[model samples]
Target chain A: MSTPATPLTDEELVLERLVALLEHVAADVLEGPVTDTGPGSLRRLGLTSVKLLEFLVAIEDEFGHVWDDDVEESVIGSLDAMAAHISAAGVAPAPTKRD
Target chain B: MHVKGIESWDLAYDGRQALHRTEDGSELYYELRGAGGPVVTLVSTIYVVSTAWRNFTGNLAGDHRLLSYDLRNQGASDGRPAEFAQHTEDLKSLLDDLGIERTYLVGTSISTLICRDFANAHPERVAGLVLVGPPFSPRGSSRRRRIAKSWLAALDAGGPRALFDLIYPLVFGDKAIAEGGSGAYLALRERFLAINSAAQLRANLREALGAGDQVERLTSIEAPTLLLSGDDDFSTTESTLDATAEIMRNAAVEIIRECGHLPYFEQPEAFQDAVARFVASVEEGTFPAPWTAPATEGKDR
Candidate 1:
């Protein structure tokens, strides 16, 4: 059997680190307006593309990596969205969803 | 480019020694950038040096009459302990010095926490206030109280850098520190950090962290207030600071995205955008709901 699935790579580790930092940033500092899950959820957060760029700079600075090089816009847009990108990038730990 | 979208000037508040001096003989040094209506005061957060707000003042300089002062016994000012009353007086004095009648006051961190106290004491003096990144609670923690006590002791001996080194790391995330290390960003850390003495730094820190528990007086603030903050600021912890926001029935909330403790620095453009919108609403003589919290909460790993 293929050697038990190898552990996350260094890039993965870096991506995970980025996600962790992103989560902290989202929860503690730049909390957009609370968004309800619906077609209109995006309108409520009040986060514009400029705000997203700010987040992009933050993630780049924190992980010592540029935006496109490591993180995709899909990942940096929101906490879970960013985490999913990390997972997809083969970096972050699989998220555990709790109801 | 001119910071804050306007011209810049080296404005100093003169104490007896020279600069922005208070009635009690304290001094407040600050940078003035901008020209226009809607006079605004930007109170520096205690944890970081006033320069930490370069991103803030830089953007706000030209549009509105902006005054970002290094609090008394702070930022190239004298080394002395200051009380809430003393700060309120300093602000009033600064405004008077500039011939500004009633101006908007914007405070972050510790300064934001006390906007109400200032408003309560001198309601007629404040036109409007924007309280951003207020303290978690007004009640002093033992550690905080000890730090406050320590500041009284530390103020006289050293300079801003020595004091900043102790406090900066906590508020500044890895980016600022690392970028600073990369020699990629401006290398004014030591210079900006070194401007004040240890005692003066402590005085500011003490005033900020030691200022715990003012929720009782929140209702007294009659000024139109805009509560600006980010959800991810672990230090202030939105829930706790929101209690104060809740106290101000007339207050509105603006929370940015992906910003940490110092969102103004982390995201100046966003900061400007959010505040500009708020200021517009205030000017239009109407207040909107501001930003609302997301209904769906993300789970922690």
Candidate 2:
């Protein structure tokens, strides 16, 4: 059977979903050092670039999108920044990204 | 009392000594016991040494060959000048040196991670796998990030002691620790910590820690797989167990009742039975689920 059309086009949603994913990755996977946070308190998590790719794969699974062409290297730097990327893509950020 | 039918032997691989070296050129140690068909090996994880597999191996070796080795940087293996050397390669080299064509794999702790990678890269070499306790990984329900925050890098700096203290609680469940033999565990621990420098331990950790989402990499492991864990194993949470089983094309998961992380140590009888059942199932060419997608079904396009 042919697939039904998606309401949101693929391009419009990719970046935003990836940002949402990075935030989730930070809390659960990376356990970012900044347990308490503000715009000024971005402490680094231990995830090197290669491990970060694993998180990206999980996000792609959660959103059902192929991260192959959509992921940008800079978009994953921080949870707040990642949230903004996802929010810009129209999905509202959840109250907590820990799960 | 000791396990009733338990056995021990000092057999060698391929009718020869089973000694092999690590990635850093450190000689590793092992004792091969039991004698049945051929199940490739036994590998050490963090704290418990290869000796822990003594009884289980004895029981299963009737028609199978069991190879249990003290991994480099741990147990009787040489731990000097350690660095994150090629662990899978060390295992392969052991097999190659022994002249054994192929056999099943059974490992514990994070040894499963190493075995999983080896199984992926050399699918042809692995007949089946029985991994116990699982290990630390980001894929779990919730990871304990706080306790050993600098643990890995510390091991890289100091040695096994850098994380062995924290790891003890993670490896042995609460009851086992309180069973009132603190000296036994500490002595065992000191022996492990004394050999390697912290930096070498760190290198071992970096190399042995779980590969990210091995669930995906494990997709390529077509061998029948068996996973054994305890209900209260802190190292392997429910989510991690479920995620692993979901991804493997052929696999089965068993939770040992009233047991801790060291199922082989905590409940050797049950562990033995579980192994017997899984191996029998493997010989029959079926599992609770296939370890990979049915090759008969074409690609998932």
Candidate 3:
């Protein structure tokens, strides 16, 4: 018997969704919509680290990914960088089913 | 060591303090004791310094190589930016500096998140986890916001002194308060207040609340785990720990009686017993995998 392989999500589509997510989180914290300068823009806006952590959580929720040890500070540095990182990293693999 | 009283002398006498430098150039103060066996790093409660572990360290140190450290911006550790993530990194660096490959993590209060996160991020480096009063889940955002607003209002209305007074009951159990009296509780209260680190603690608290939910990710944890929460612990209750245990592959839960959040200090004998059993199981390779561990059968010790 043959098993069906999981379909891969398009990278651009993933990036588009992530950008939208970041934009929403930024607006929530900044109290207004922000330009797509990426997460680096967050630092300029004087975003607190607590808010930054919330942003990361939002990103994880959006991409279905958790921040691993390899995740550098720069991964969330800007919108474009984060989007690219998410696109390249892709959605975190669904945990394998256990008995 | 600055030994002030008999209590201070009891704590300072056992372990030698050292500064573990991180790549960020911040130095974390830690004290290590014990001998040839599994390494156990005790992450102190945010409310107290490393000495808070003094009650049980003597017992723990005899069988396991135990290490306890002050979180950055608390105790003897140098002040720098206090981010929850940075605290985890500091722990990683602390373990590395000590040349410890893998060890058991014993964390209390908010530091429980540190142990879990470290285990999640570096599973190979964590042999097992003992989380006492881990904030497995926090109140909803609106509720948290309301509570925070009220707290801030109180802070502005009164001051740190008043705020600390208000939160004292939540920190210590009725039994502890009754035993220690207003005086012992006051002495313990004075320790945190005297440090003038309210702002530091506030920042850490905010980070912890905003650190996001880890419920979905608990299945990723592979290490043998033991969770402890007090019967009187209002924050992280038995129900919360029960929910937490359901997700882990291997976990055991114990609710300590006549204690609140800080069991290590509140009930050291009971705390030591739980930890000693867990550590021994891990060392002997007899710890059941999370999948095999009984899900709903945690004992109340």
Separate DockQ for every predicted complex = 0.02, 0.01, 0.01
Residue-by-residue lDDT tens digits, candidate 2, B232-283 = 6877765676677777778777777655677776566577667777777778
What is the two-chain DockQ of model 2? 0.01
Candidate 3, TM-score vs. the true structure? 0.65
Better of 1 and 3 by DockQ: 1
Candidate 3 residues B115-135, lDDT tens each?
878888999999999998776
Interface root mean square deviation per prediction: 14.3, 21.0, 18.0
lDDT of 1 by residue, A1-99 (tens): 567888975554654554454445445434543334333232223333223334444554654443342232233334545434444545333342312
Off by over 4 Å in 1: A1-99, B1-18, B47-54, B138-166, B173-189, B209-212, B290-301
TM-score of 1: 0.60
Model 3: CA > 4 A from native: A1-99, B1-15, B138-159, B288-301
Candidate 2 docking quality: incorrect, acceptable, medium or high:
incorrect
Across residues B142-178, which tens digit of lDDT does each residue of candidate 1 receive?
A: 5445544554444444444444444455455454445
lDDT by candidate, in order shown: 0.55, 0.58, 0.65
